[model samples]
Target: MRLTVTFFTSMLSKVVNQINISADLNCGFELACQWRNNTAGEDSGDFLITSNVRVANHFNIIPSRNNSDELFAYTHGPFDGMQKATLISNTISCQLGGGTLTFWYYRTGDSATLEVCVRQPPGSLNTADLRCFPVFPKNYAHQWLFNAVEFPPLTQPFEVVFLV
Candidate 1:
């Protein structure tokens, strides 16, 4: 099960720039599996940050949306059962109003799942408090697909989590 995530966009005035997964600012992944940035080598890794051209050539899939260069990916392996990668974003201020979070994704293989979740206070430990949107790919996707989730207004800061 391999999942690739492209750029993330927020329809908010404060978040004007597109979030880059390659940069270490807001993105983070679990260390239990192999995770790499800017490379698609399958030697031994869980998550990967690679370019659209590189992944397209490697996985025989279409290029990312808008021909974007950077991508965040998670590759599957024999030991993938119960293994997951959690990509966490930096705190987002939602004082004005909650907005939609949109991104393009490409996935291949079976027996894997992807989820989008939001946590308030940024460091909350309670899983029950998370508002999650789960995406189950019934068929393997060969092209990029669009997804968006709308969140309600919140006075406190929150962080978005991508679990795979």
Candidate 2:
């Protein structure tokens, strides 16, 4: 007996915007941000540049210890436990291999964390959903370092986010 062969066709639907967080905070980074502070004097916003990364600005040199010519940092003043920087990204279509959410960080406060997380489409993630890899815990190093977390495979679209 001979075997028969069959073939099926599938069409690609939505397109995914591959995002890489540029040092300028525009790597497809959406600023649906919010913060709670003890006073209104705090200046907290989306991801900002810092001149403390152990790594150089390999992309375009926004701001770093080596290149302090440009001021790329967004701060919440010298306050703590009150000021927060939560960066939320726009939705991105998940692909076969998924993608990575990365950034260069330099820690300052002893009680601060660069919490990395992702959001499922439609609904966002809560603190319980945070499973940060490549964590850069609060350290006085103030040295630039890269944190890259890979997104697991997802059938639908999703967003990558983290708080500073």
Candidate 3:
């Protein structure tokens, strides 16, 4: 499946002054992928950081919601099958009431699918343990769409995983 995912956190305004801190500490911070290209001889570890992705004859350019140049993307390859690609966020320590996760996604092709999941214990990727949110994206292709999922108060640090 070919999927492009972009994330923006409204909570960034709370700690804008502490931009140097790791995102894990801020809980609510912009999530951008580190520069990597699967087709350029780099480690194609499930996901890649890119600004643009082309599908068939349609080219999609994803402008960062955080005012950055690049967004994270999952490209389709010849080997695509039941294989899954995941993009996991840093551990988030929510406040007393928790918060909402908002992001933009662009999907192309008939088989493309995306899911937002919350996992406790941070590093666990076990499918059975994932608490997936029922947030689904619209069926429109070639255009970016917005989606938000609200989470309850979390006493322990947890991670949000974007599975495609």
Candidate 4:
């Protein structure tokens, strides 16, 4: 018996920016993953960051207290009730530079608002300095969304926060 193999060539192209994060632990992390958010303020995505496990048949973000740093995600019922999942690394600070804010999201509830913002520390999240964008719910599959905000270079250290 003889087995023959056929060779075919295909090309895939994508554009990506490189971001380097440095922490006190003397370790750094690469910023990856597409960014998206709530269009109507009440929708979310459920995928394990490590295992890469996603809830295919239903929609729900399970609460995890296991990891000290986790992503806090919430989803509505039948889809799984709204519960807070540990969104790793809540307090993230970055060197202020003019860039865009991006994320991955899943919307599985009725029309609602998704809130994303850049906040200042030692102040109320609702204050004027907060930059908030509203995303609408139209799909349930994993989707990536992004918003470009003109940010001036930072002269001092500040915190970057995202809320859904």
- Top-TM-score candidate index: 3
- Candidate 1: worst 10 consecutive residues by lDDT? 31-40
Note each model's CA RMSD in angstroms: 8.6, 16.4, 7.0, 14.8
- Model 4 poorest ten-residue lDDT run: 2-11
Candidate 3 pairs with clashing backbones? none
Off by over 4 Å in 2: 1-62, 65-73, 77-82, 122-134
Candidate 4 lDDT, tens digit per residue, 1-164? 11111001100112122224523211111222322222223334322233122444543332233433433333322323342211212223455566544433445444334454555541233447665555454553433333333445554444343333
Give the C-alpha miss distance for residue 46 in model 4, angstroms: 13
**For model 3, what is the error of residue 38's alpha carbon versus the real structure, in angstroms, after optimal superposition?**
14
Write model 2 residue lDDT over 22-135, tens digit each, in one string. 222232112212211112222254334333222222223234445344333333333354545554444555546766645555444445555556656523334454445536
lDDT of 3 by residue, 62-95 (tens): 5645465644444454224555555565556543
Candidate 3 segments whose C-alpha is farther than 4 A from its true place: 1-45, 62-74, 77-81
Per-residue lDDT, model 2, residue 4, is 11
What is the lDDT of every predicted structure here? Answer: 0.50, 0.40, 0.51, 0.33
Clashing pairs in 1: 34-46, 38-49
Off by over 4 Å in 1: 1-46, 52-58, 65-81, 137-139
TM-score-sorted candidate list, best first: 3, 1, 2, 4
